[model samples]
Every structure is written in structure tokens, then in C-alpha cells.
Target: MPLSSLPAPTSSRRVLITGAASGLGLALARGLAERGDRVLATDVARARPDSVPAGVDYLPLDVRLDADWTSALAHVRDSWGGVDVLVNNAGVATGGRIDVATMDEWHRIVDINLLGVVRGCRTFTPLLKEQGRGHIVNVASLAGLVHAPGMASYNAVKAGVVAVSETLDHELAPHGIAVSVVCPAFFRTNLGASFAGADGDMEAAGKRLLERSRRSADEVAAIVISGIDARRDIILTDWDGRIAWRVKRFARPIYRLAMRRAGARIASTSHTIE
Candidate 1:
């Protein structure tokens, strides 16, 4: 379907969001449901989260598990006939310099952050193909595009999400499936709780950034919904992200210098316990 074929804003599309127990995922679920969309809000927890908004359905879905995806698909088919939108929002947070980060850390982040989105896309693309009209939204981060220091694993995986979303936008356009990748800069969320890195200071630094952010998850979720309605292929949800991306694209010299300085500062500050 063409971008113009997307359902109208007033239409109540069936939407499914992963990691809906908390953070941006929870906010998306709430916003979409309040807008009258039939929402299935899923998380890794087996029991329904009390934080889930009223009238929204709940399911247990660990994106890293194949069986969970199968079950989610079954539920969607049985309950909603089929999905009109899929939001792959589940991910973990990790940060470390190349040498400081362990292979296990790299593998775990890739499995949960990058491949998790990949699995969601693979699982639902066939249904969207048959329907010939649907949307897939992947939640990435500014780190995906604006690579800074001490977050190599996170940057790589988020960049992967952006790449995969772009590829699918083209590949699925012929099949009438719209794909969007959302890259929001840091915001106030419990994402810091999920932080896993070789250096404790890296996690501390990430938390500080999150604490300092002006944007909230709810605000970002609203932006994402608007972007999806507009059928945007790349949605940058904040000014910081937009500015950073523009600088990287249009002012390479400045961006490079900034990154070098950030890297040097991090290298000087980062400390790992033996």
C-alpha cells in the first residue's frame, strides 16, 4: 500500500506493542488505546502489569523467545482477526568502549535489541503482506544515529534497527506494508534500570543523561503516533536527535570533532572494577 493508504487518524486500528509493561512501550500502549485503537500491550512478565491502561489487552511476550512470538500472533489472529500495526519496542540498554565491553555483553545486547526487532518483523510481515495494508514501528534511539562514546554495543544495535527498518520500508512497500523507525533522544524513563555495561561509570553516565532529559516517554510516544499517522519512514522524536542527525549529515567536520571530544572525555572518566 502507498503511504496514502494508511488508515485515517480516526480509525481504530488493531495495534500491538512489545515491552508494554513500562517506559516508552507502556506510554505508546496508553496513548494508542486512549486514541481508540484496539491495543495489545505485551511485556516479559507473565502476569498482567497493573500499570497497563484500562481497556487495553495484556499478553506475556519475551521478544527473545520464538514461542512467545508464535503465541502473540495466535492471540492477535483470534482476538483482533489480524494486526493493523506492530510496534517492536522491546530492548535492553548497554554501554561500554570496544575493549572494555565483553563478548557476552555484545551478544546479549544484539540478541535483545537488534534481533528482537528483526524477529518481530519476520513474524508479522507475512500477515501484513496478506492483508496488503499495515504498519511496523521499531523504536530505536538517538544513539543509533549519533554515535557517542562508551556505548558501542547500543549504537551498533540501534543503528541496526534503523537499517532494518529502512530495508523493510522498501521491501514491504510493494506488499503494502509501511515501515517506520523511531529514533528519540534520551528521555525520562526507567531505561536506566536495564543498563548493562562493563564499566559501572558508563551506566552512571547513561543514567545522568536520562535524568537530564526534558522529554518524557509519554511525549515521545505521542510523537511516534503522529509520525506513524504521517507515514514517516524515519521519525526523530526530539530536537536534540534531529539536530544531531542533521549535523552528522550536513556538517560532518563539526560532528566528528564533537564525537572525538566526547570519546576523549569518556576515556578519561570511565573506570572498570577488576
Candidate 2:
């Protein structure tokens, strides 16, 4: 079926966002609301996050569960009529040497990071196709492109997200629905709160990197909005994100050397707890 035409950009768009309790998701929700969008913020938290403002609606959604998606979308249908944008921004980071990480750990990471995105895409795509003019944005990471040592699960899932987004871009463009992958460097977000398989050393390394980067979620949200406005297929945020994209594209040797050094650093961190 040919998709319905999109509503005006400046008008209120019925936007469904996952992981909207904190960090990038929350920031994006607020930003979208500020742009005259009726944003529905969903997260695992039963109570709404403080970062979310008064106007946006908050609903409990565990992206790891498929039933939760159906319920959330049902509410959207009931209240807002239908959705125009879907942001699959919910994810968790797990850091560890692949050998030290157990199967359970791998499953937890993959289920939330990669499969969560898949679930959101599958669940919402029909509604989007009916709408005709909708966009799906998947939040990936720079680690997806430039490998991050010790963050095996995080790196793997994010890379999968990138691949999914790229593939969807080609497939959905004909349907008038767009897909974008957001590749952001270490940003000032609590993205590391759900560390499942990472050791203390790996955790510490991640904290230090996040602190050093100090990029705010609001900053990244602005970039994301701009990317969506331009209908870009790949959205890069922060200086490191842009640099990594360029390096991966034009300077493979330099990117490889950097990855090697990063691996060495992670290896040097004495494993206190696995």
C-alpha cells in the first residue's frame, strides 16, 4: 500500500521514543516536544525520569519485552491517533573480554541492544507504513565502526544496529519511510548503568572515557534533530564520532592503529573481577 503523506514538520508529530527516561532518549524527547511534536517517552522505569518535562507523555516500556511494545503502541493509537516517528534509542552496554563473558551475559546484551531495536522496528513498521511519511532512527555508536576492546557485546550489537539501519534505508526508502543510524562517541549519559558482564577494570575504563569526552545528551539531541531534518542516513555526533567516520572511510590504517592502542590499554587494566 502507498503510504499516507506526512504532516507538516513544524506541526505536532506523534513521536514514540524508547529509553526516554534519561540521557539521549530523554534529551531527544524533550527536543522533539520543543519542536511542536507530541512526544511519547517510554522507558523501563515505572516512574518517569526527572529529565522528562511536563508536556511529554511517559509510559513504562521494557524494550526487551515484545508485549510491552504492543501495549505502548496501543496507547499511542488510543490517545494520539497514530505515530509519525519512532526512535529506537533503548540499549545497554556490556564490557568484558569475549572469553570472560558468559552466554547469559551475551544474550542479555544482544537482546537489549540489538534485538530491542529489531523489536521496535518490527512492531512499529506497519503503523509507519500506513502513515506513509515516517522515519525510524536507531541509536548506534562510534564503537560500531571503530572496535572498542573489552566492550565485545556493546561493539557487536552496535555494529549490527548500523547494518540494520543501512539495510532498512535501502528497503524503506521506496515506501517513503526513512531509516537513520546514530553513531555517537562517549557522551555524558548513564548509558553504562546496566553493566552486565564487564569487570571492575572495564567499568572504570568506561567511566574515565565518558568523563573525558563530556559530550552532553542535549548536544547530541540537537545533532540528531538536524540529521532528521536533512533526512540523513548516517548521523554522527561529537568530534570523535565525526573523526571515526572519516577515519573508517578514508584512513583505515590510522583507525586500525587506534583500535590496537585501545585494546592494549584495556588489556593493561588488571582484571580484578570478571
Candidate 3:
């Protein structure tokens, strides 16, 4: 189904968001709630984190657990009757060259960043299918669309999200479920604090990029909400992401050159974390 033909988002929606304790997830929860949506904000922490906006329901959800997913589904069913949206936004961050990143690190990131989203979709998709009208929003990153050097694990998992989201968009269209994959550039968020890669230089570089980001979590969340409302299949939340995607698609040679330059820079400065 063409996006134009899909139903527009109603004023009040029942939105379930994972990783809502802080950063982008928190911002998203607040944004949706402020708009009068019934928001179920969840996080992995045993106790609810401070600063979650008032009037939003809180739940403890570690996206990696099947039990948690099941419980979240049950909670929504009991409270809201059914969910209008599922935001698979719980993820951790890591960055290292493939040679430097350990198999254990790769496994951990993939389990959380990629499989976490998978679990959410797998658990909630049946409910969406039953309702025959809903949405799935997966939070990816600019790295998903533009693979940068020294971020093999992060890029791979985020790209997996983008791919899974795309596949679901087509597969679920007939079921009246729209899918949106958000590809936002680095923004001011706690994502960097979760970084646990093997390369010190890569980690430093990533932190620097994040520190320089002009947009805050709330700003990016607002753009993402707009994209969801518009029912966009791919939501590039910033001009940087938008331009990068276009360059890769329409100006391949330039994109390749830029990537090569970035790789060379990383290669020159790369060093293992002690």
C-alpha cells in the first residue's frame, strides 16, 4: 500500500516505547504523551528512572527478554485495550574496527541492538496483525544508511534494523501495519555513554562527533514523531542523514570517495583501548 493511502495517525494513540528512561526514548515518550497519546514508557532499569514526564505509564522492559515482551503486551492489552504503535528504540552503542572489536562485543551489541528490535516486532506483530491497523517504529541511525569506519558492529546492527523494517513494511502492508525506520544522525543523548568498543581512538572520535551534534534528543524525537505521523517508511531525522543518504544513492562516486577518506583517517589514528 502506498503511504498516501495509509490511514493518518489519529490525535490520540496508544504508544509503547522501549528504553524510555532517558535520551531519545524518554524524549519520544514525553513528546507523544504531551500530544495526548496514551504512552507506556519502559526501560531496562529495575526501578523507574527519574525525569519521566507525568501522566505516562511506566513499565520495566528489557527488550532482550521474551518474558518482558510478553508482559508488555499484556500490560498494553489490559490498560489500553490495544496499542497503536510499537517503538523498538531500546539499544546500546559500540564502535571499533572489525579487527579490533571482539566476537563477544559483536554478540552483545547484536543481541541488544538487532535482536532486541526483532523480539519486539515478533512479539507485537501478531497483535498488530490481529488489529489490522497499527505501526512499528524501529530506531536506527545514520550509520545504518551510511556505514562509517571504526563502527563495524554498530553499523551492522543498525543496518539490520533498517533492512528488517523495510521487509516488514512490505510484508505487513496488507495487514494494515505501517513500518517506519528512523535514521537519525548523532544527537545529544546518553547513547555515547553506553559505548563499549575495543578501540580508544574510535570511541574518542565517536564521542567527539556526538558532542558536536547540534540537535538534542528532544529535537530528534520531534522530527521522528513527525515522520511517524506522515507514515514515512524511512525517516532520516536530520539534514546530515538526509544528505548522506542522497549522496550514497545518487552520487555514488562522491560517497565512495568520502568513505575512503574517512577510512584512511581512522586507519591513521586507530589505537586499541588499554
Candidate 4:
């Protein structure tokens, strides 16, 4: 359905977005608030000045911690009466080939990127169910659908998120709850800089990819919020993301070949001494 035809979000729609201090989350918060929805913005770091829209309630939250989710949800319930939408937008990337990546890196990525969404869903679903109708937007990535070199851990977690969100869509649909999983190809954001990594090469590669990507965070945020309003099941933020998913679905052999070529290029570059 077209976004224009979906249910209009009004002052009665209460929204809670994680990672709202910056990037797509912040953009969505501002957009929703401008549309007159009461927004509760939460993030791990301190709230950014001028990042949140007027009337938005900003809360400090660490998605990795269950206590943080509980407190944030309570604050939202107390202030807004009930949450109409929950955007699980908080995530972190870990860079490096699987063999070279440390156990700590793998655990950290899974803890935040995958389990964070799980925790949010587990905590907020009851609140949403009580309200009888709501939306859950889980931000996955294009990498979640397709393999990418040097992003094994991050990809694994995001893929898990996609799977979990899809399952929840089925499970929650019967309860009048909607779930949308966002798969953005790439956007101009601080994700690369903020990604936890010890390897310089992996970090450089991540930076290079982020710089080359065409999408902006605002564009991604618009797509996400529109999808939520439309009650879409899968939200692809850009043409690249849509095309990538298509290739993965209908042209698996070709996609595998492309991945192999990219992997070969990385291997060749790694062999050359600096």
C-alpha cells in the first residue's frame, strides 16, 4: 500500500525509538514529532543538542542491558499512556573476517545487534498487546540478506534480526501487532566510526564502504517511518537494497559469483605488503 493511504499518525500515536541521539533514529524522531506524534527518543550516549524535536522525551538507554529497556519502556508508558510504535533502531557493527575476528567482537555484536532487538520485542510486546494495536520496526541491513566480506559477525547478527522479525511478524500479526524489518544498503551515518573493532584494516574497509554508499541517513529515516505508517512487512531503504534482495532471491548463483569475486579482490589486496 502507498504510504499516503496508510493510517495517519496523529498526536495519539506514541512512538519510542532507540538510537535516537543520531543517525536514522534521530531523523525519524524529528519527523514523527513534526507530524504531531509524541516521540520518546532513547540512546546509549548523551542526547544530542538540537537533535531531538521539541516535545520529544529523550531518555538514556543501552540496548544491551535489559534494565535500560525496562526503564525506558516504563518512562514511555508513564508519560505517553501507551506506546503505539516501537522502533528497535539501536545497533553496532563489528568488522573483520570471521577467522581473524576475536570472540569478544563476535559476542559484542550479537549482544547488541541481535539480542538487543530480542530484548526490546520481549519487553515491549506485552505493552503493545495491551494497547491492542502497534508497530515494531526492527532495523536490519542489506548485509543481513546477502553475505559481505569482512563483516561476518555484524552480518550474522543482522541476519538473525531479520529472521527474528519475520517470525514475530507472523506471531504478532494475529494479535493486531505489525512488524517491519528495515534493510538499508548503506547510509551516511556515524555507524562506521562508532563500530567496535580492533583491526585497523577492518576499520578502514568499513570506512571506505560507508563513504562510497549513496544513501543518506535522512533518506533512510523517511523510508523507515513511511514503512511503519504503511504497516509494511519489509522496508528496503534504497534501490540498491531492493536490487540486492532480488538478486539474492532469484539469482542466487550470480550473487554467489559476485561475492566470490569480491572475496578474491580482498584476498589479493591482503596478500600485498604495505
Clashes of 1: 1
Return the TM-score for candidate 1, rounded to 2 decimals. 0.96
List residue ranges in candidate 2 displaced over 4 A: 1-9
Worst 10 residues of 2 by lDDT: 1-10
What tens-digit string does per-residue lDDT give for candidate 4 at 218-255? Answer: 76777787888788998888887788889989999998
Worst 10-residue lDDT window, candidate 3: 1-10
Clashing pairs in 1: 1-176
Over 4 Å off in model 1, which ranges? 1-8
| Candidate closer to the true structure by lDDT (higher is better), 2 or 3 | 3
Q: Kindly report which residue pairs in candidate 3 clash with one another.
A: none
TM-score of 4: 0.92
> How many angstroms is residue 247 displaced in model 4 relative to the true structure, after the best TM-score fit?
1.1
Q: How close to the true structure is residue 149 of candidate 2, measured as C-alpha lDDT?
A: 76
Question: What stretches of model 4 exceed 4 Å from their correct place?
Answer: 1-11, 46-50, 271-274
lDDT per residue as tens, model 3, 86-167: 9999999898987888898899999999999999999999999989899999999999999987788999999999999999
Clashes of each: 1, 1, 0, 0
